[model samples]
Target: MIVGIDISKKWFDAAWQVDGQGRHQRFEYTDEDIGQLLAQTPEAAHYVMEATGTYHARLALRLHESGRRVSVVNPLVIKRFSQMQLSRVKSDRADAELIRRYGEQQPLSPWAPATDEVLELQQAHGWLNDLIGERTRLLNRREAHAHHAKPNAFVISQMAAQLQQLDGQIKTCERHLEVMVKKSFTELFERLLTIPSIGAKTAIELIIVTDGFRRFEDVKALCAYIGVSPTTFRSGSSVNGKGGIAKLGQGRMRQLLYLCSWTAKTCNPACRALYARLKALGKPPKVINVAIAHKLLRQAFAVATTNAPFSTEYA
Candidate 1:
């Protein structure tokens, strides 16, 4: 038996298949509703749902804890799968059916919830990012005021105070995050820090994004998840074009990797060589930078996996 669920903030639609027969239903976003739905499902039935942020987390966790097989798939993958169908109708029930069909047709890995420490790290990273963005906005506003002929002293003073507060908060968040990483993922964090151009901030961010290196199976999977892997674009002879990175994963992680790649290309011997070769071949800077980012991630993965510090000689 296979079950597919389309999750939303308030409710979820469900579709089930058994003995080549199909059924569809809807339920409220409550424990009672979930219990009622599960009553009809076999204990061994496989449940599939999309990763709809926090909306799906509680239900998925509950289902998993109840000894059900659960697969939380990426929304993009489900969307692409839906596009294959001939029917143009779109609704919650339809989506549930699509997800059910998708689960039936595709081989999907079961989902695993992150550990408490990893979840805490993810939240801390989000707070740090928010503080950084606030600081940037304040700085930009201050800069604009400085350029004005008749700047408002009061506004400028307020902006300065806000910036100072944000800076302090940012520092505190970083310190707390460092302590968490050291306590929960000490060896992995240390190994990542040993990589060229990977500082404490970048290493911590990588750890959080990779769920302390527990999410992906290999360097290639890591690259694809971070949107650093190149994606080919080709059809018949009439639609041939240059391929590029998919940019389908976490955008912030890709941006951070790009920034790190700039430093890696200059400081890391292996990355520098690759950068120079690509430049000599007249590859664009964007393409070269992405390649360097991919290389850096691969190195990070290797050192972390081996529980060893990064070594340039091996590179």
Candidate 2:
């Protein structure tokens, strides 16, 4: 029985028994509720739900423990899909139905959580990033006030001290995560470390972004998945080769890649040559920057996929 689940905190709605033989049935999300539902279900392959607000995770884990195949779709993909439905309506039932069709209509894969260390790194990294963003925003506002508002009234010195403290903490957290990564993935970390520009932080960030390198099938697909592929678009009779970074994948991954690009431009001969060649061909600085980022991802992907150190010989 294929199932589409609309997950919430206490209760969940399910588009039931998607054998295409019946309509839909809703159920509560509890041990008893799930146990009873499982009793009635004729063993199925896939159970699909959206990755809804960290709530779906527990239920999915429980379901998996009980020998059921459960998968969580990203909300963005599911919502974008909902727009295409001819009779699109906003309701729990509608959501469940969309999930049902998403399961039924497409070959959706199961959800798998990253390992504890990767999860820890992601949590720490995201928190530090948020803190940094908040600090930047506060600093920027204070500076703007000092320049444009009552200049004497706005004070920025104390906040600058706080910013320095936050920066130190963020760096400490990053170093700990990097150490954890080195312990967890010894071989991969060693290989990535050989690349002068691919540092511990960048490699660990890649692990989180790759979900421990599980989803990608190969390097080209990895590049596309990271949204580093230069896309193409056509309008009416005109074609433009101007589509840049897809900006659709993990932001953290893209950030690491950008940093890698900057580092490689200095430390990597191939990357330096490529960047120069593109500049010579009249590419915009931003375009060349993005291309450099893409190249770094490809190198990182190659290292991860092959479990080998990056070779300058590839250049």
Candidate 3:
């Protein structure tokens, strides 16, 4: 048996098929409601739902704790599947049924909960990003205020105070994240740091995204998950398009990797060689940077899987 679920902020719709007929139900997110939903399905049933941010997290965890099999799929995958099936309806109930059909036919890996430390690290990382964004916005607003014909002293002072507070908070969050990584993932973090141009922030972001490098099996898989893999467009030799990244995965991670590539092209031996080679071929700056980022990921994965520090001599 396969059960499909569509989760929202306040409620969720669940659907399953029995004897070639469909059954559906909607329930609020309460312990009783969740238990009731579980009772309707068999113990061996496979549960599936899209990874809708925090909306599906708690329920998925709860279901897992009850020994139910759950597969949290990427929303993009489900959207593509819907399009292939010619699914025109967009209601929650329709989505639930579509997800049920998808699970019934598609192969899905069983979901596992991330470790407590990793979860905490992910939360801290997100908080730090939010703090940094706030700081940027405040700085821009303050600069705009300062350029006014008659800037208010009181307004400038308030902005300065808020900026100071935000700076302190950001530093505190970063410190917490560092401490957590050191305590829980000291060896992996230190190993990643040995790679040239892989700074503390980049190392931490890599750890958070890859779940300490346990989520992916190889460098290629990691690149694809981070959306840095090269993609090309050509159809029967009649239509040709410039090559570019797929850009289908973690946007934040891709941006961070691109920023790190600037330093990597200078210090990292392999990345530097690749950058120069691509530059001689007249590749654009952005293309070179992305290639360097991809090279860095390959190096990171090599050291991680080998359980050794990065060494150019052996590499």
State each model's C-alpha RMSD to the native: 2.5, 2.6, 1.8
Which 10-residue window in model 1 sums to the lowest lDDT? 80-89
For model 2, residues 79-191, the per-residue Cα lDDT tens digits are 87887766558898888878888887878777666667777767877776787787778778767767764565325667667778878887887778777777777788788
Model 2 misplaced regions, further than 4 Å? 18-29, 151-158, 239-241
The estimated TM-scores of all candidates read 0.89, 0.88, 0.94
Better of 2 and 3 by lDDT: 3
* TM-score between model 2 and native: 0.88
The CA lDDT at 139 in model 2 is 78
Order of models, best lDDT first: 3, 1, 2
Highest lDDT: give the candidate number: 3
lDDT of 3 by residue, 257-292 (tens): 889899988988888889999999999999899999
lDDT of 1 at 180: 96
The Cα local distance difference test for each model comes to 0.89, 0.77, 0.91
